[model samples]
Structures are given as structure tokens and as C-alpha cells.
Target: MSTVPKREEVAKEFQWELEHIFESEKAWDQEYDQVKALIPQLAAFQGKLSSAAEVNKCFELEDTLSISLERLYVYANMRLHQNMANTKYQALSEKARKINVSASEALSFITPEILALTNDELDALINNEQLKKYRHSLEEMKRSKAHILTQAEEALMAQVSNISSSPNNIFSMLNNADMKFPKVKNEKGVEVELTHGTYIQFLESKNREVRQEAFKAVYATYGSLKNTLGATFSANVNKNLFYAKARKYDSVLDMYLYGDNVPTSVYTNLIDTIHENLPLMYRYMELRKKLLGVDELHMYDLFAPLVDEFDMNITYDQAKSIVEESLQPLGEQYLSVLKEGLNSGWIDVYENEGKRSGAYSWGAYGTHPYVLLNHNDNLNSMFTLTHEMGHALHSYHSDEAQNYRDAQYPIFLAEVASTLNEALLMDYLLKKSTDPKEKLYLLTYYADQFRTTVFRQTMFAEFEKIVHERTEQGESLTPEDLSSIYYDLNVLYYGKGVKVDEDIAMEWARIPHFYTSFYVYKYATGFSAATSFSKQILDEGEPAVERYLGFLKSGGSDYPIEILKRAGVDMSSPEPIQQAMSVFEDLISQMEELVK
Candidate 1:
């Protein structure tokens, strides 16, 4: 058995390398002082920005200051996130955040003021030799001229950024820090706490009773706080509505789809398509019910292992090789970067007490992308490794290829790279495994991916759309209202086969995405896009590989859907979603064959 160190011991053992950021804390402090001194200078360019020289000077100075401030902000926040209980780091992080916000407010007038200038004036400035350096930035600013608010309004928005983020912050605190769950007994008579972090593990438990009990216990806690959660959800919906109105958007949906240059049809289409596919999902549930030999399958039994649990245990070293081999289709340049990342400590690869739960890849421009994972040496963790590395490699390529302004891709396309990596890894494993049970497990696992990504996320998207539309129509949602809407959707998708418990009605309270305003739909869209891309890569080989790699390298230089289109996936069409559902159908057929 692996050693379980004390919480304090784990915190002491986990230290991130900040040398890439600054030589020392003293140096970071010095930089912070420099940023503070520069903030006032930024405020001096408030109104007089008509001249080309002035505009050019402002852009150069602001870019330098913003990049420096971001480095400090990212480093400090990452340090604090690494260990939330550390008061010193927490204080330092808060200070950095405030400093960055102040800097943003100080520089806020540049865009709006620039936007206020007539097209002729902007053209004159752009034509000037000095401002020529920022031609792309100027052009991009002009693209959003219609949406740019006045200088005063922009300043107001910047000042309120922290307050605007409060809903997500409160949700995080409630879900991760404050919430508690009852101890649940497994089939082996082992007691496990049903915390948010451990809930997934319990769902995957072999014992049906354990999974059901854990799900009930966890959702029951969420159900109790339904009122508070409703308020939080309302606050978030209001925030989105506020921004959409302020930006002159027809609706919040328009504002969200505006950023990605996609139409509302894309969102509605996923919902419509998935609604049509509900019977397929129900069929899968029926199969699961029969396989488990249960009278009824509860929502908890959704994640139970389909076969005897196989320990596809892999060491960190083995994981690296597996990911590299699986991703070989992307070519040597990609593999070389992965190798560098493995050697350069870009990954914090193990679970420890007090470390932030979950896996994610994060970094600032001009730094190596870093991945944080709670590696458990199982197939799930192995897939997570590849998934996060896909994000890191995407960031690496983008940061190398695009300018700082365009390097950060939107959330719409972010999942494409990550999920594509997962699809690739699944294909690799399925081909390598010949054992019937192992193959059955792998196929079932892939089917679950479809269920979670496509079915569950679409269900969430529909829930969000309904809640937002109701709020837009001047209706208020009580906790009961939210529960009823969520529960009905669950019944629609799960059908009459599975037992939809009353506690499952309150599941909406526990989901963080309800606060993100139509964000979950991307997971469904992304999976569809990934499925299409993965198939092309496997079928067409090198040419398709080139396009796929280029997609990763493109970043935010263009719209995400357009970028994927260039890479060989047309998300505008419903074909990809249909293809993903077909993959699910094939999996069901295989599982049926295996069970027979």
C-alpha cells in the first residue's frame, strides 16, 4: 500500500518551481513595486489618445505592464491554489489580485477611448509609422468597436470584475471547502466519506448499494442548501444578463455565442439532437439494468464498473510512454515537446492532502504550461494525464506561434484538444487489448464518455437554457422550481427504466456549471468535434495529421469553429453529433455481444 502522509507533511513536501517566474520572492516584490509605480503612469493617458504616437506609446507600455502584472498574478494565485491553507501565500495572492485589478482599471480607458475615435481617425493612426507596430491589435480593437463601452463604463466594469466573479467563488467554497458528506459503507464494510472529491470514486464502486448510498448522501447535503444555491444561481444569471444588456446584446445567449462567432442554433441543435437521442440513452440504461441483475438502476449505479475491475495499473514512467505512443499521430515535434515537459517539471503529478482537488492545465504566456493532477495509477488517471497534457501541448504550441494577445484560446475550443487526446488514447487501448472482458470494459468506458459528455452535458445545457429564458421572461426560480426542472430532464433522458430518486432532483444545486451561463454545451460540441477529428486522423493518416496539429497551433488567431473547420471538422453541421451517437450505438452493440 502507498503511504498516506499527514496533511501538514504533504503541504511541506509540495513546492512549485517559481524560478521561471522570478529569481526569488525578493525579485517578485521588486517587480510588484515596479508595477505599482507604473499604475499611476497608465492613468495619465486618460483622455488625450488621439495622436498616433500617443496610441502607439500607450499600447507598448500597457502591453509590457499587463504582461508583467499577469506573470505576478498567475504565479501568486497558482502558489496559493497549490496550498489553500497557507495564510502567507493567501495574503500575497490577494494583494497581487488587487494590484492586477487596479492596473487593469488604470489602463481600461485605452480600448474604449480608442474605440470612440472615428474610423478615419483610427485609420490615420494605423497608417502612421510609429503605430504600425500594433496594427493587429488596432485592427482587432476596431472589430469590436460596436460593442466597446464608454471610458467611464469600461472603468466601472473593470472595477467590478472581482465582485462579478463572486458567484463562482461562493460556489467553489461551498462545494469544495465548506460542504461535508456522511460516511458511506461499501460492500466490503469499509467506511468512506462522500466528499465531492471522493464521490466519483464511490460511483465507480463495484457494490451497487455503496454507489447508491453515496449518491443519495451527497445529493441530500446539496438538497438541504437548495435556497442558498438558488440565490447563487440567480446571482450568476443576473451577472450574465447584466453584461449582455450593457454590451447591447439581444440576449445573454447572443453574448456568449458572440465571443465564439457561433450562432444560437449550435446550442439549440445540440439540445434538439440529444433530445432525439434520448431513447438510445434509455436503451443503454436498460442494458445496464439487465447486466447488473438489479430490479431498478438508480442514478448512482450509472458509474458502476461493467465487468470485474481490472487493475490496469501504470507507473508515472509507463504513463509517459503510453501518452507519447498514443499521441504519435501528431508527429515528432509534438512528441519532442511532451518529452521536454516531462523532463522540465511542468507536471505536478500526484495527489496529496490539501492540494487542490481535480486535474487542470495552467500557465501564463512566456512560461512552460504546467499540469496539476491527482494521479491514482489507474486507467482513469492515465487518461487524465493524456487529457491534461493535450491542453499543455496546445498551450505550448499556441504560445510559441501566436502573439500574446491571441495566444489564449476561448473555452469553446479548449476542450477539443483535451477530449481529442482522450479519444486517441481510448483508440490505442482498445486496439491493444484482445481479452474479451478487458475489451468490454474499454468499450463500456467509452460509452460512458458519450453518456457524460454528450448526454449529460446536453441535459445541463437544456437546464441552463430553460432557467435563463425563464429569468429573462421575468420569472424567479425557487429551489423547488430548479429541482423540478432538473428532475424532469433527468427522467426524460433516463426514461422510465431507471429509478429517478427525489434526491436526484436537487442534483442541479451541486453542479458548478449552472453558474457558468451556457458553458456545458461546449463539452458536447467538443466531444462531437473530437470524435470526427479522431476518425479522420486514423483513416487519412499524415495529411489529416498535419491539419490536426495546425488546429492546435492556431489558437485564438481565428474563430474556434472556423479553426476546427479548417482542421477538417464542421461543427455547424449536425453530422459530427450524429457520428458520435453512432459510435455509442456501435459500443452498445459490442457490449450486447459480449454479455451474450
Candidate 2:
């Protein structure tokens, strides 16, 4: 039996250095205590914001307290992610969560108190020289003044903040800690434990029987808990709906986009444009079917190898080097920081028992970013390496260029740099490969990215819109309803040449992104924006690199749309999506030509 190693069994270097954030549990506890003490000090500034000096003082103290709280929260949660089954870290994480709620309740009064001021007073603060560092924040507060609740109401919501987040936490605990899958036979007929980290590996297996068995086993596990998963997801949707209504937003999507100031049309236009271009998706699926020579292309075949004998097995070291070389277009300083980050204690690089399943780049503002990766020696894992480092470097650059008040980039723009890294990596490999078969494989590889990131994620986005709207209209989604919605989308997206298997209906039960509602859409939009950015950088060289970096460094100082506009891609317009679709079409044409 093949099984995952325990956290202690994994080597130290592969683990992220949590010591950099908190030297010891003692250190973490001290900082947690310090942040709690400062929350009361923050609350004391409740009724004193008339003068510029007082406002500036209050803002500075709030920044200190907030950053400290962020550090505490990040450290504790990351510790838990190492092994969710670890009871000690779980308690530490919950302790961090409670303090975060307390800190939130204490600080919630600031926004309402600021909103309570007269228009002239607000305008004055926006232009106040003493508060020059916070001009953008003040402007944002003014923009959101209409939704800002009274102090008492904000405090009440803050008190219930942790309760509202219950669904996501509950799902996380169940999915990561408690969920178990029986071992399935591998391609070699050896039994291996089915895990979240290995599920994709099995799906991508060249052996069809192995793929089908893994798929059935994994979903059967999720299917057993379908009702529980459905209720959890419904609770999450209600949480969003409740907050949206409380904030006086017309819809949950509007509430989410309001932070980045993105319009609903941008969201709708993406779906509309993709719907118009889905024939390209059909064309790609047909090509896939022809290449694989399978009588029917089942859902499990989506990630199967398209071309024979073009294996790109990459070790983590090779993945790092290849990613670094691929990003050379971004210039030396970018490479320098990237290399340092890769070598430094900034990433937790392998999977252990009960570690978080997927990959993400995260860190507190002042610290270097950390990437969590469940890496395998395969082409897909290499892409994930570049993808996640893109996020880490984006965070690094933003932290370097902006103050803590503006350092974090908006979610709307978060995926741009990451996908751009992927674009560059694909471009580099295509250029380097001398073998025609390898070249064809790489082309199909990138084409599949479009299929997955753009088309597939758009489908997920549409599903969210449907489910959320249904819930908003007083329909609670049962397990059947969720599966039906997901199944219909599979038919729509892959119906032409693929089998659209029944087990795929339960696929949503395992999707972690649904927990972060409306987030899947950004993957689609970001792929488009990054395609445009990559094209510009390759064609225009230094000038484009400068603009792209400027966009990254702009952080959350401006609206995401405006930042992208200035950086040369206008996401509000459908041109980027259309351009991305055109690129996808070109890849298909190239593949058709090559096969001939």
C-alpha cells in the first residue's frame, strides 16, 4: 500500500519556515496577546476624528494593530495547514480566529464614525495633507459611505463575523481533516491511497481503466457526503446573501465586485463573450477526441496526454530553474527577487499527510510571500510552480512599492501575474522544444489551459450565478439541484465530442473554490488579461515589462479596471477576452496543421 508521509516524516527544507513569522509558539502567543491589548486602544479612538492630527494618529495606530493582527492570523492558519489533523495547531488557529473577531469588532466603529462626518468633513479628510499617506483609503471610504452602517450595527455584525464564516471553516475541516478515500489500484495494479493531492495525477494517467477507477473512487467518497456538502455550500451562499442585503447591495455579485469597483457588465460580458466563442471549445474537444482515438472522450480524459512520447517529467529543482528562465522576459531585478524567494524559506514545497490540497501564494504584508504546493514530477505541477510564484512575486513587488494601507492587490487583479507567468512558461517551452511531437504536446497543453481556465471556469462562474440567484429567489439548493446544475453545465461546455459522465455531477462537491463565491470568474478574466499582457511584453519588450510591473506595484491604490486600463489592457472592454479566444483558435489551427 502506498500512503502519504506524516508531517514529521517530511524533510525540513521542503517545509516553509514559520519561524520567520513567529520564532516559537511562545512568540506567536506573545504577539497574539499584544494584538488583543491594542484592540482596546483602537476602540478608545471611537469619538475623536474631527481634527486631521487626531485622524492621522488614529489611522496610524489602526495600521499597527491591523498589521499585527494579520501577522498573527497568517501564522496560525498556515501552521494549521501543515497538517489539519494536528489538534495543537487547530486550537491555535481557532484562538487566532477569535482574536481576529474581537479585533474586527473593535475596529468596525472607525468606518462608521468616519462615514458619520459631513460631506465637507469627508472631502476635507480626503484632501488633508496630514493624512496624505491614506488619501486613497479615505477616498474609498467616501465611495462606500452609502453602504456604511451605523456604529452599533457595524459592531454587531463584527461580533457575528466569525459565525458568518462558519460554513467555509466547517467545509475545510470536513474536506481536509475528516474526509477519507479508500485506496484504488494504480496503472501498475498496485493499490494506492486516494487523496486530494493525488486525484489529479490519477485522472491524468495514460491508462484509461486507472483513470476511471480513480474518478469513481474519489467522487464516491464525496458522493457519500453530498447532502452535508450541499448544506454547507448553501449556508455559504446564504452568508453572502445576508451580507449583500445588509450592505444594501442589489446582488451578491455586486457586493463582491464593489470592493474592486468593477461593474456587473464586466462579469456578464465575460460569460457572454465566452458563450459566443464556445464553438472553439467544441472544436478543441473534437480535436482531442480525434487525437486520443477514443470512441468517446469521457470527463476523466480531460487531462489525459494528447500526444504520445512527449513526456515532460520535471523535478522540483528543474521546475524552479525552468520557471526562472521562462520569466527572463520580466528582467533581472524580477529574476533576482524570484531566485531569492525560491531559495529562501518562502515556500512549503511538498505534500504531507493532511496538508492543504491545492496551491496558493500567501503571506502577511511585511513578510515575503509563501507558496503552498502539492508538487508531482509532471508537466502540470511545473505549470503550478510558475503559476503560484507569479502570485508570490506580485505580492512581493506590491509590498515593496506600496505602504501597508495599500499593499494588498484586489482579488480582481490577483490572477493576472500568475497567469502571465504561465503564459511565459508555455512560450519558453514551445520555443525550446526541438521535437515536433513535444511542440504539438506543448501547443495542446496551452490550448487545454484555455479550455480549463477560461471556458471551464466561466462555466463554474455561471453555475454560481445560477445557484446564488436561485437561493436569493427563495430556493434552497438540495444536493440534487446542485448536481443537476453542474451536470447541465458539463453538457453545455463539453457536450459535442465528450461523454459527459454521470459521476461528473458530483464534481462540485469537491471544488474548494465554491467556498470563496464568485472567485472562479477571476481565473477566466485573468487568463484573458495575462494573454494580452504576455503578447504585449513579447512584442514590445522593455516598455511592456515596465507597464506590467507598474500595474503590479500599483496594488490596491486604484480600482482594478483603472489599473489594467493604465497598464494597457482594458478588461472592462471585451477585447482582451476576444483576443484570448482568437489566440485559442490560432492554437487549434496550429495543431491541425501540425498533425497534417
In order, candidate lDDTs are 0.84, 0.90
- Candidate 1 lDDT, 240-309, residue by residue in tens: 8898889888888888888677888889888888887788898899889988889988888888877777
Estimate the lDDT of model 2.
0.90
Candidate 2 Cα misplacement greater than 4 A, ranges = 1-40, 68-106, 150-202, 209-243, 308-320, 339-381, 470-485, 501-512
Error of 2 at 286 (Å): 0.8
Candidate 1 achieves a global lDDT of 0.84
- Which pairs in model 1 have colliding backbones? none
**Candidate 2, 1-596: lDDT as tens digits:** 54788889988878889888888989988888888777888766779987788899999998998888888889989999999989998998899889888878888778878888998999999898989999999999999987878778988988989899899999999999999999999989999999998999998889999999999898889899999999999999999999999999999999988888989999999999998898899889889988888999899999988887567789999999999999999998789999988888888888999999999999998888999999998999999989899999999999989999898888789889999999999989988988888889899878988998999999999999999999999987899999999999999988678899899999888888998888899989989999999988888999999999899898888889999999999988889999899889988998988877
Off by over 4 Å in 1: 1-40, 74-99, 119-202, 213-247, 350-358, 474-481
- Candidate 2 — which pairs collide? none
Query: Against the hidden reference, what TM-scores do the models get?
Result: 0.85, 0.81
TM-score, cand. 1 vs. native: 0.85
Please state every model's RMSD to the true fold in angstroms.
4.2, 4.8
